[model samples]
Target: MQKPLTDFPTGSVVRIAGIDGGRQARSRMLAMGMTPGCPVTVLAGGPTGCRVRVRGSEVVLCCGLAGKIMAVADDSDEGPRCNCCPGPRARAI
Candidate 1:
């Protein structure tokens, strides 16, 4: 079984897998450099918004927006990874 975006912890480097909403949603994600295959690091998350680090930029996305984005945990232990490394494997939400 594959891991879902919600499986990642507050700070984990992940790769964008899929977007689960409409065109507008997809477009918004794309605008944030969240297109499939892009890497994103979870900064912080709550009921309100999730702070994500993408392409060296930090952005906050609401829960609704975050729910639309699908991501996979990046298991590669490549150096320092991202500023938001939530440690080992995280369970799904």
Candidate 2:
């Protein structure tokens, strides 16, 4: 179920499961609010990088950084609510 963040498509809602990189990468992501269990919505992506919304803030990550982020589909009943997400079943992916 876990996959690199870059594997997800636009509008997909997923949760951060872990980081695949070293301490520095993890620390940087953490400071950006990309911690385990944090919800992320893929706003847009390509081979180079992607944009995501985390806890209401938008953050851009290069492919290398995004590849270091392990994520899984968010299947909770409540999911993570946001103006963009709207509801549990509103995900575009």
Q: Which pairs of residues have clashing backbones in candidate 1?
A: 11-86
| Model 1 lDDT tens row, 1-93 | 234455567977777777888999889888876666567778886556688888778888877888777776666433123333354542212
| Stretches of model 2 off by over 4 angstroms after superposition | 76-93
Candidate 2 backbone overlaps, count: 0
* Candidate 2 to truth, TM: 0.80
Write candidate 2's Cα lDDT for 1-93 as tens digits.
788899999988888778999999999999998877677899997668889998778899999999999888887533233344455444433
Off by over 4 Å in 1: 1-7, 76-93
How many steric overlaps are in each model, in order?
A: 1, 0
CA lDDT of 82 in candidate 1? 30
RMSD in angstroms, all models?
7.4, 4.8
